[model samples]
Target chain A: MGGSTVEPVVRESVGSAPGNLAIASLARTLRCVECGHETRLEVHQSCPACLGPLAVTYDLSTLRGSVPSDRLSGRPRSIGRFAELLPPLSLPWSARLDLETTPLRPAPRLAEWLGVETVWLKDDTVLPTGSFKDRPASVAVAFAAAQGHRAVGCASTGNLAAATARAAVRASLPCFVFVPAGLPDSKLDPVRQFGGQIVEVEGPYDVANRVANLAAEAAGIGVVNITLRPYYTEGSKTLALETFEALGWNPPDAIALPLGSGALLAATERAISQLREIGWIPSGPGPALLGSQPDGCAPIADAFDAGSDEIVPVEHPRTIAESLAIGDPGSGYEALRAIRASRGAADSPTSEEVIAAIRALARTEGIWVEPAAGTVIATLRRLREAGTVRRQDRVVAFLTGAGWKISHAVALSRVGSAPIHLDPVHPDLSQLHVGPRPEALGGAE
Target chain B: MTTLVLASVLRQSAPSLHQKEYDGFRGSLLEFLNTVSAEGGPSFRGRIFDGDRLRRYLNVFVDGTDVRYLSGLATPITPTSRVDLIPAVAGG
Candidate 1:
C-alpha cells in the first residue's frame, strides 16, 4: 500500500488578462475569474484572488435571429457570413473577405471505418490562410481597424502569423508577427508573403510569445492575441453555427477538436448553447465536446484525469504539429469547464498515431491534414473503440487546417505517394532497349 | 504581510518594481520596484526600476487589460481591484 501512494500535484493559479480593453458602448466587458468582477474597462495584470485567468464577458443573453440559410449563400468565401455574430463594424465587403461559411462535408467512409453511422469534417483548410486561425484573426483584425488601430500583431507559430498578416493586409494595415526562429519554414513562408515585419526570436515559441506580448504592450499596438483576443475568439463560434446549420440545425452527437489555446472548445460549446437560446434549434442533448492534443502537449488532458481545475505549465514543446505546439494554453481551465458542462471528454494521441492518422486521411478521405488534425481524427477512432462515441451517433470532427501549410510534418511522417522512377532521358529509344516492358529495361547495355 | 511586486517579466532584465505601497490591492506591484530613478530602475512608463522588470511575454493587468492601454504604471487601482499578469502560455 505504501508503494501505491499517489503524489499530489500543486495547482498554481492560472493567470490571464483581457486580450484588450473592451469598448463601453460595445456592451461587452472583461470578467475576473477569481472574484467575478465585471468591468467596462481595465488596465492591469493578474487577478487578486487565486490569480486565475480573466475572460471576456459578452451579453449573449440578448441574442436574436437565425441566419437564414440563404442569408449566407452569397457572401464571399470568407468568415463573414456570420457577420451578425461579430462585433459591429463598417468596412468594404471586399476588404473584409469574410469566411464565416466554410464547407462541412460528410465523412461517412471514415465513419464506417470507425464504426460510426454519421460523421462530418468541418474543413477549415480552404480558409485564406489555409488554417482555422484565419477565422479568428479575420475578426480580430477587423475589430482592430474598427478601433482605428493601424498595426496588428500576434504571438504565433505559423498559422496565426499568416492569418494576421493576410487580414491586416486586406485591411491595409501594417502587420507585425513574432514567431520562434525554429518554426518550420512551411508555416513562416505565408507570413512573409503577406509582407509583415517578422520578428524571429532565437529562443522557443514561448520566448517569442513573450517578446510579442511586451512589444504589443509597450508599443500600444493591437495584438490579436493580446488585446483583440475576446473578439478574435468570437469568430470561432461560427464553426459551431456552421456545423449545426450544415446538419440542418441539429447538434451532433460528438465534436472532436484539436486543442491549442482551448478557445475553440469554449466557443464551440457557446455556439451550440446559443443556437438553443435563440430558437434557431430546439434544445437537445448537445454534442460531447471532445478535445484532442498531441501527446507531447497534452496538459489539458493531463489535468482532466488529475481532477483539477488548473494547469501545470510544460516547457520545451516537442511535436511536429507546430500549429498546436502551445505549452501553456491560457484557456485550458476554461476548456475543461466547457467540456465538462457539455459532458464531453478529452484525450491525447502519440506522435506515431498522429502521423498514421494523417496518412489515413490522405489515402482514405482525399484530405491531407497536419499532425494536429491527425490527432483529432485518431482520437475520434480511439473514442469509437472505447465506446465513448456510439456507432449509431453522429460525430463531427473539426479539422482545423490544411496539410499544405505543414507539409514538412507530413513529409516527415514517412508516408508518400507511390514513386515512379522515370528514365533520365529518352536516349535512343531507352538506349536501344524496351518499349514499356520491365524486362526490356533490365538489359545491361 | 508579504508584498509581492507584480511586474512584466522581460526576457533578460529583472522584474522591475513600480510602487512601494500596496496601492490598496492584495499583491502590490509597487513594492517590487528597486528605485524610481529614470535610468537606474527598470524601464516602464518612461521610467526605470532595478527590481523585477516586466517580462517580455508578460502583460500586467489591473483588471485584465494591459496597463499600456491605459496609463501604464500610472493606472489607478482600488483596494478590491485585482492585478493579473499573462504570458502567451501555449498548450502542453
Candidate 2:
C-alpha cells in the first residue's frame, strides 16, 4: 500500500494556465466538507483523504468592499455576473450558451394566504431547459469544454437530463444520459431532441447513477454530477445570488426550496455565507434555509425530524413528484447540517398535499409549477401553521420546474362536460337551448 | 479478531469475500482492506481501495455511522466493532 502508485484519475488534456491564473489572484482551495482535508483543484469526485464531498473555498478578503452594488447591477443578468466567486472556467460568454436569469416575482396573494409580510417566488421555470438544473448544467458543460473533454454525461431523474443535453449540444460536445426505465415521454423527448444518447436503465435512479459512475470512471467521460461535481455544484449558488440581488442585496428572512439531492439548498446557503463574507450583504446570519421533500422520498427530512446526523436511505421511493424522488440523496448530510445550522426546518409533504399545493399556487399566483415546486409551497403552508414561519417574516419559495412538462401527472378532480358538436357549414341551431330572455332592467325592450 | 460484512454488490467482485473474520487485525481501516485484498484477490483490492484510500464511491461503516464522517481510512477497528462496506448509492 505504501509504494503502490495510483494513476491520476482525470487527465489534463488541456493547459491548466487559465484555471491557475483565475485562482492565483484569489485565495481559493478545495476542502472536504466532512473532514477539512485539502483536495487538489481538479475534476475529482470526492476528497482522497476522507472520501467525503469536496467544496470550493474562496478567500473573500479581496472581494470585500470592492464589489460595488452598482458594479454587479451593471453586469449582464446571468450567473456569469458572479464570476468572482465561482470556480474558474475558460469558456467565454460569447462561446457559451445563455442560461438566462429567472424572474423573482412578488406573490402578494401568496403572502396574504400565509399571512406573511411579503413572499417572493424565485421562479426557475423560465430557465433554458425549463428547470433550475440548467444553472448547474451551464457551468458544468463549460467546465468540461475548458478541460478539453470531448464528451459529457449524467444520470438524471428528468430535469437534469434535459438541461445537460441542451448544454452539451450548445457546447458541441457529445452527451450521454442514463435515466430509469418507465420515465415519461415529456422528460425523455427533450433529451433526444438535444441529441443526447439516452440509456434507459432497468432499475431506479440510484441504479442508473451507479451505472453512470462506472461509465464515467471506465471511459473517462465527464459526468457533471460525478467527476466534475466540485465545479458543477458551484453553479447553484447563483440561485441565492439572484435572489439577494433582486432584493437590493438584502437577504430574505426565510427561503423554502425543494430538496432532491439537497445540493441546491446547500449551495444556496454557501452563496449566502460567501456574500456576507465579501460584504455584498450585511454581516449577519443570512436567511433561514428551509428544505422541502416529497413524502415518498424524504430521507433528509426524516433525519432532520429524528435529530440525527445520519440519513437513512429509502429502499423504494414512490411519489408523483418524480423529479424529487431521490431515495438516497448524496448531499443529505450537508443539507441537514445547513438546515440545522440555520435553525431551519425540513418537511415532506404527501402526494395529495403536493398536488393540491400545485393547484393552490396556480389559483392564487397564476404560477403553474411541477410537483417538486409544489412541495415547497406545501411546506411553507405547514410552517406557517406550525408557527415556525412568522407572519412578519419575508419568505421566498423557489419554484424549480415548469408545470407544462408534468401536466399529465396533475389529474383534474372534475372533468368538464363533453363539448356539444356543431356542423361547420350547416350549424345545428336546435342543439342550443335558450331560456326565456331576462326582462329589461327599466321595462324597455 | 474483527468481523467484516461485505455488501451484496461487493459479493459480485469478490466471490469468496463475505462475512469473514480476521484474527490479529488490530489496524486502521486501510490496513484491514489491504489485508483482505491480499487474501481475496486483486479484483477486491481494485473495487475497495484506490491506492491506500478507500474508493470515494464506497462507504465504510463502523457500527452504524459512515467512517468518512468519523476518521476515514485512519479510523481504527476493534474486536467489538462491526465493519460494514456498503456501495455508495445516490439518485441523480
Candidate 3:
C-alpha cells in the first residue's frame, strides 16, 4: 500500500508577453543532461559536455494565465490550443497539422465490469495516426522545422513511425523510419501511405534505434524521439491537463497508464503537479498513478522490485503490444521517481491477460484497443480483483491507441467472427451468425 | 574465423553466469551490448573498453543463467553458446 509520497509542488513560470518571442526563441538553447549546463543546441544528438542527451527548457510562467477553459474553443482543434503550455512554435499554425483533441469518453461498462466507479477512456484511436505518438510527433516536427531542420526520423516499433510519417509528410520534411522487420503490416501500412522512407533493421527494436543518433547529428535531421525530446515530451502533458479539465476540474483517484518509453506517465505526473501549483486546481489528495507494461518487456517493473533506480535492458521484446515494445526506456528512472513520488503502483500483465482484456473492452465498452491499451485495462482489472483499486475510487483507464491500428492482435483474440465467405448477394446474411442461430440452417443440416 | 562470445540473462529461477568465449560472436556480442546500452536506453557511465557496468536490473546470460553465477564478465565463451541480455520482465 505504501507508494509515492506527496512532495512540495513547484511550478516553473512562463512569463505572459504577447509578441514577445523570448519563450519560443529560447527553445534553441540546449541544457546538458548530466550536468544541466546550458548552451546552444547541438547539431548532433549528443551533448557537447558529456555526450548526454540535451533537453529543451520552457518558459512555463508565460503560459500560466494563457490557457483558459474557452481559449481553445475557437482555436484549431489540436494540442496546440494548449500552445501556451508548450515550447513556443515558430512555424505558422497551419503549416503544422493539428492532431490532438480526440474523443475522451467514459467507459462505464468497462468500469462496472472492473467494479470501479467513474472510468474514462482517453480514446486516441481517432488521431490521424491512430496512436498517442501523434501528440509528440506533431510538436517535435514543428519544433524541428522551426529550428530549420529539413529531414526527420525515428526508430519505431510501429506507432511512432506512423505518427512521424504523417507529421513529416504534412510538414514537407522527408522522413526516414527504422523499424524491426517483425512488426505487423497493419502498423506499417500507414507509415508507407504517408511516404515515409522505411528501413527494416535485422535485429530488435533497440538495434533499429542505432541510426537515429548519428543521423540526427550528421544530417541535422530532427529525430523526434532524440533531439526534440524535451519539447516533444511536452505534448503528453496535455493528456493529464485535458483529463482533469474535462472531469469538471476534478482529478481522478487513480490514473492507469500504459508504459513504454515512460514519457506519457512522466508528463502526466508533471502536469498534475503543475496544475495544482497554479491554483487552477486545488491539490489535496494526490491521485494514485499506476503504470502498465507487458510482462515480456518490463524493465521498470523489475527495477522497482529490486528497489533500484537503474534500468536493465532487455535484448528482445516478445509482446503482442509492439508499440510498448521498448526494451529500455530513457526516462525509466524518472518514471520510477514520479510513480514512487505519487505513491502509485506498477503492473506488468502477461500476453494472455493482455489479449483477454482487449476482448473485454470491445465487448463491454464497445471500445476496441491495441495491446498497449489492453495491457492497461487488463492490469486495471487485475488490480481491482486484488483490491489495489477500491470500488469507490474514481479511476481512469487510459486507452492509448485504437484497436484498428493493431488489428493483427485483435484478429488473434478470436472473439470476433472470422471472415465470412458470403457472396455479394448474401451480404445481408453476415449478421445471421450473430444472436441465436437461425433454426433454418440447423434443419437444413 | 573464431572470436570470443559471451551471453547472459537475469532470472529468479537461475543465477547469473558467463561461460567460455567461443568463435564468430565477438563482433555481434560487442555491438549488441554497446549499442543496446545507449539507444536502448539506460546510460552506463563507464567506457566500453574500460569494462561494462551493467545497470541495476540488467542480466547478461551466455546460454540461460546470469553471468554473476558463472564468472561475471570474465565468464568463458565458446562458439556454440548463445548470449542474451534479458530485460527484467517483472510483474505480479
Candidate 4:
C-alpha cells in the first residue's frame, strides 16, 4: 500500500461557494447524499459528516431549455461539449485527453429480434481505452492535476487500469495502478503501455482496491475511484446526457446498463433526475433504468429480485464477465434506489446467455462488445419476455466495452461458424464454409 | 457495555483505539459518536460529524448492519449492542 514521490496538498476551503449561482448562473457545490451538507469545491474529500459519499450539484434552478448553453458551438465533439453543467475544470492543453462522443446508433435489427419497437445501442466501444471508463478517468486526472496533486492512480480489474493510466500519462503525472496479481498480460499490457507503474497486489480486486486507497491517501495521489470519485463519477453522468441529446432531448422508454460497482447506472439516474428537474426532459415518468449483471456476480440483481435493499456481497464471484465481477459493489444501494425509483428492475443473465447475446449483437447490429454489455443484452431479452419492458417500448442498451477485452473468453466458448482452415493449394467449396446465417447468431452456421 | 469499533482509514484518527466498552451510555448513535469523536481528536471529530449529521464517508453499523438501513443515528443501541464505525470504501 505505497508508492514513490508523495506530497501533501492542502485545500481548507469550506462548504458550498453559493450565491454565485443564485444570480441565475452556473454555480456548483458538493453535497452529501446521507446528510444534505454542502461543501465548496476541493480535492480529496467525502462528506465530512456521516462519512457518506459526496456528489456535485448544479444550481439549474433558473436555467431554461437545453443543457449546454450555446457555448459549445465551436468546441470539439467530446465530453467537454457539455461542460456547462459539469464542475469547472482546467485541463491544460498540453495535458489534455479529449473524450470523444460515442455513437447512439439505431439497432433496428436488434429491435426486430427482441420484438421491441425500437432499440438504440449506446456504443461506447470506440472510446479511448476501448471502454467507458475513459470518461471518468479524463475528469479525475484533470481534477487531480488542477488540485495540485503530485500523482494519480486507481485500483482496477482491467478497463479502469488502462483508462486511468492513459489519462494520467496525458496529464504528465506519475501514475500507479493497483491490480490483482495473476491477471493476463493482455490486460496489464494496455495499462503498462501508458507508462503507468503497475503494482500487482497479491490478492483479489477488493483487496487491491483497499491497498490502493490506503496507498493513494498516504501518497497524496488522487485515487480516481476513491478520493477523487466525486469528480470522477461526475464525468460518467454524461453517458445519459450524450444519449438524451442524441435522441433530440427525448428520454427513452427504458435504458439498460451493465451493473458492477453500479456507478454507471446510478450516474445515469442522476443525469436523468437533473435534466427532469430543469425541464429539459418532460417531467412525468422518465426512462426506466434496467441494471444488468452476470448471474455469478449479481448482488444488486439479487437484492432487487428479493425486494430487499440489502446487498449480500458475492464473496467469490465466478463469471466470464470479468469487468462485471464486482462482488461487493459500493454503489449497490444507489443503483437499487435508481431502479426502484424508476419502477425498473434488476436481473442477471447466465454466462451462456451472455455469450449468446454477444454473438447476437455482433451478427445483428454489427457491434461486438465485452461480456459486461452482453449481460445487458441478455437482460433486455428477459425483460422484454416478462413484459417488464413492453414490446412497444423504446429501449437503449449500453454496450460499454470492446469485445477484444474479453475475446479470450469468447474464444473458449463455442462461437460463430467454426474456423475453416482451408488448404490453399487445393481449396475447395466444401472446405469454404459460407452457409446460411443461423436463426440466432450463436448456433451452427 | 457496548463494543464500539472503528475501521479502515478512520482508525488512523486514534491509533491506540480498538474495541471500546461503553457502559451506561445514553442517547442516539450520533450522541455516542460525539463522545467517540472527542476521544479521537478535534481533526478526526470534524471529519466524522457536521453538527447533528454523520459525515457522508462513514457508515455506522449496529450489530453488523449499516445504521443507514436502520433508523440512522437514532437506531437505538443498548449496553450489549455492538457498533461498528466503518468508513465507506469504494469498489471499482
Candidate 5:
C-alpha cells in the first residue's frame, strides 16, 4: 500500500498563469547522442545539425535545494508536483490527474514465487488511459500545448493512442493517432471515446508507423513519439523517480523492465545515474538492469545474446504482445549498451511462457497484465535459474499496462477460463467443480 | 555485395534489408548515402552527413558494429557485408 505521495487532506487549488507563456524546462540543452553537439532545448526531435537522438541533460545542483521542500509533499500526487528535475512546461496544475502517482507495492506472494527477498511491482496500469503511455503522453501534449501547437498526434501500437488522445483532450487540442488496422477495438474504441480521431493504416504496426512519420514531416503535426520525442521520451524517468521515492530512497538490487524500443530500460539507467550524481542514492553497485521481451520480436535480447553491437532489423515482428512487437527498434543500441554496462542479461520468453506468466501474476498477485509486462515475469522466472537474479536481491518488476486492453485476445482464448453455461437451478456453489489450472501454473516452478 | 539495411524512417523513401542488393559495390559509406539520397533517400547534403563524417541523427553500422565505434563511414565493407542505417528516433 506504500505509494510515492503523502499529501494533506485538503489541498489549495492550483492557480493558472496569465497568458500561455512557454516556460523554460530546467533542461536547457540537448546533447546529440552521436555527435555530442548541444542545442537549445524546446520541443525538438533529432538534433538539427547531426540528426542524432538528442539526450536531455539537466543541472542537478539547481534541484537539490528545491526538490525536497515541504510545500511539494503537501500537494496532490502528480508528475507536475515533481517538476524540479523534469522538463520545463506550464502544466495545468489545476487538473487533478496529470501523470498521477502510481503504486510501487511490495509483492510478498510474488517474492515467494520468484524466490527474491522483496519483490516490488511498479504498477503503471491504473492511469487514466490504463497504461504507462500516460507518463509520456501527458508531458508531450502539455509541452505541445504550451508551445502554441494547434493540434497533436502520434503513431501508436494502441496504448499510446488513447493516452495521447486523453492528454490532448485535457489541453483542449484535437488529437490524431495513427495505428495499424489490425489493432483490436478494445484499444481503438477508447481513443474515439476520448475524442481522438484514429487513422487506421492498411498494414502492420510498422508500416502505420512510417505513414505517421511522413505525416509528422509534411503537416508539421506534433507527433508525441516522433516530433516531440526529446521531451516525450524523457517522461519515462518519472517511473524510476516514483519507484525510488516509494522505497524511501533505497535503490533496489535489480529491476526487470518490459522491453519495447528499449527506451524505457535505458531511461531507467539514466534516472539511476542522475539520482546517483545528485547524491539522492549512494554510489557503488547500482541495480542490475534486466530487460525482457517475447521471442516473437526480441531484437535487443537476441542481439545481446549473440553479443552483437548492432541491432538487426526485424522487418516483420510477430507477437501476441502488440506493444513490444516493434521489428526495427530506434533505441535498441542504447538499451543494449545499458544492459551490458550493468553486467545484466537480456532474455526472451516464448509466447506460451509469456501467457503463462500473465496468468500466474493474476492468480498469485491479483494483477492481470498483458503479454508485454508478462515477459518481465517470465524472464525473471528464467533468470532465477541462471543467477542473473538471486534470492537475496530486492527486485522490482515494472508492470507497464493493464490486461483489459488485451482481454479479448487472452481472456476468451480458451474454453476452461471462459464462462460456463449454467441453468437456473445450478446457482449453488457446489455445482462449480473447478480443478487446478494447469494453464496458469505451467511456469510457476 | 553490401546490403544496407535501412531503418523504418529511411525505409519510407528507400528500401528495406531484403528488398534490394548492393553486390560488388565499391565506395565509402558517404558515397552510398549520396547514391541513396539521389534516389530520394535521406538527404545527406550538409544535413545528415558531409564529405567525410556523419552529421546528426543517422547511425551507420558496418556488419553488426557501429561505424563510429569502428572507423566512421570509412569502415571497410566486404562484398557480403550488411550495413544498417538507423535514425535517432525511438518507436513505441
Candidate 6:
C-alpha cells in the first residue's frame, strides 16, 4: 500500500522527431507483432490499430557489406559498438552506460563435466547493475532522455528496477520504480541507493505493472518497459552481438538462457537474424535458442510442451527463483516462435534442480549467479541428456545475475538449517572436523 | 447482472463500463462485450475490442481466470460473476 505521493509529471506530446539520416536510413517502420500493421516510429506502447506490441522494422539493404569486422572492433566496448544494427541515437557512445562486451570466458572444466566438446559462459553477472537488464535499461533510458522526457520509470521484478535506476542516474533523469510488495531486501537496496523513488504495490508483479502502465498513460511519464519498450527492447540484441564478437563472429551451435518475460530470448533471435541479414555473419543457421524456466511458473515451456501457440497464464506463480516467476510473460508468443524457428527446445526445472545447478556452476566454472541463471545450467544438462545437444556442438550458457544478491536463498538450500551457535572464546573442535590437506594425502604430489 | 471491473487505465475510455451493471446479460464474453459496446457507444467499443476479438494487449478474466485459457471469446459469464479487464503486464 506504500505508494509515491509525488505529483504526476504533465504529459508531453512529443511527436517522433524526423529521425537522423543514419536512423531513418536503417529503421524503415514500426510493425505490429499481432496484426502486421505498419506505422511511423513514435512514443507509444502497443499498436494503435490493433493494440498489439510494436516491433521495429529495419531496411537491412542499407547495412549490406557495411559492417566489416574492423568497424566493430574499432568501436568502444559498449552497447553502442554495433550502432549500425541498433536503433540510432544522437548520444555518443561514451555518454551511454558501459554495459556491453561482457566477458565470454571458456569453461573447460564445465565442458569436461558435461562431456561436451566446448562450453563458454557469457558472464553478464559482471554488468554495471549486476544483471543483463542493464543493457536494455541503458538503451531505454537514453531513448527516453532523447525524446525530451525529464523522468523515467518501470515495473520490475528486481533486476530491471536496479538497472533502470542506475541508468536513470547516469542519464541525470528522475527515476520512479514500482516493485511488488515483499521483494527481497537485497534487490530493493540497490534501487534505493541509486536514488529511485520506490513504489511498492500491494500485489503481485502483474498488478504493479498494471498500475505503472496506468500511471504512465495518465501522467505522460516514460515507463521504460511500457511506453518506450520498442526502443528499450532493442538494447537486448547487444547480448547476441557481443556473443558473436567474442566468438570471432562465429555463431554458437546452441545457446541457453533463463526465460522470464521472454524478451531477452526474442531479442537474441532478432540479433542473430539481423547479423546474418547484414552479411556480418555468414549465411547459415544460427544457434539454437534454448529457453529455461522454473517449473512452478513456466507458461511458455508449458505452451511449448503442449504444442500450442497460445500461452496460458498462471494465476499464481510459486518458485524459489523469484526473478523468473513471471506467470504471464509478455513476450511469450514471440519467444515460442523464435524457439521453434531455430528448432530449439524449452525446459522447466524444479526448485531442487535449480539449486543443484547453482552449486554446480559455482563449483565447476567459478561463476556465482542467481537462481534465474541456474535455470539455464539445469536446462543445459537436461538437453544434453536428451541428446538434443550433441557432444561435438559448442554451447554457450548465459549467466544473467550475480549470486551474492541471492546468497540467502543459496545458503538455505545448501544448509537446510539455521547457523550453529558457537562460543568464539571456547569453540568445540569436535563439531568442526578437520580434514587432512590434499597435498599430504596424495602420493603424486 | 454481472459486475464488471475495468483496469484504471481503461476507465477514461470506457468510464460507463467501470463497475457498471449489465442487467439480464447472459452469454459468452463476446456477447457481453457487444452489449457493453451497445450501451457505452462507439468509442468504448473500439477501445475494448477490434471487431469481435479483444485487443491484443488487453486481457479478460472471468472470476480471476484468464479467458484465453478458458474458452477464449466464448468463455461464459454468470450474472453473479465478476469480470476484469487488464493490460498485458511486461516482464523482464
**DockQ comparisons of all candidates to the true complex:** 0.10, 0.17, 0.05, 0.27, 0.27, 0.38
Question: Candidate 2: where is the Cα deviation over 4 Å?
Answer: A1-27, A93-95, A412-445, B1-57, B60-91
Q: Which stretches of candidate 1 lie over 4 Å from their true place?
A: A1-34, A41-78, A93-97, A416-418, A424-445, B1-92
Instruction: Judge candidate 5 at residue A127 and give its lDDT.
Output: 83
Q: Highest DockQ, which number?
A: 6
In lDDT terms, which candidate is top?
A: 6
Tell me model 4's lDDT, rounded to 2 decimals. 0.77
Task: Decide which is better by lDDT, 1 or 5.
Answer: 5
Q: Is candidate 3 or candidate 6 better by TM-score?
A: 6
Over 4 Å off in model 6, which ranges? A1-25, A92-94, A415-445, B1-31, B39-56, B61-86
**Could you give candidate 1's per-residue lDDT for residues B3-65 as a string of tens digits?**
223334332132433223344443234432222233223234222322345432344555544
Comparing 1 and 3 on lDDT, the stronger one:
3
Q: List, residue by residue over A271-321, the lDDT tens digit for candidate 6.
A: 888888877777776589999999999999999999998887876788878
lDDT of 3 by residue, A1-445 (tens): 1222222121232233221122233234666445586766433333433334345554445334433443343444456555556666654532355555776687777777788877888888778878888888887787777778879888788888999899898788899887877688888999889999888877777656644543555576677876667667767887777777678667788999998878788778777876765445667766888989899999887787678866776767788988888876766766787888888888889999999998888887688889999999988988898898899988887778888887678768986566667668756674564576534422110
The sequence of per-residue lDDT tens digits that candidate 1 reaches over residues A305-399 is 67777665556678877877777676777788888888888888888878888887776568888888899998888888899888998889988
Give Cα-based local distance difference scores for all models: 0.66, 0.77, 0.67, 0.77, 0.75, 0.78
- Candidate 5 local lDDT, A94-151, one digit each (tens): 2423666899877877777777777899999898888898988887787788788888
Q: Of models 2 and 6, which has the larger lDDT?
A: 6
For residue A167, give model 4's deviation from the true position in Å: 0.3
Candidate 5 lDDT at A308 equals 92
Worst 10 residues of 1 chain B by lDDT: B31-40
Better of 3 and 4 by DockQ: 4
Per-candidate TM equals 0.74, 0.78, 0.75, 0.81, 0.80, 0.84
Give the per-prediction TM-score of chain B. 0.41, 0.86, 0.45, 0.83, 0.70, 0.87
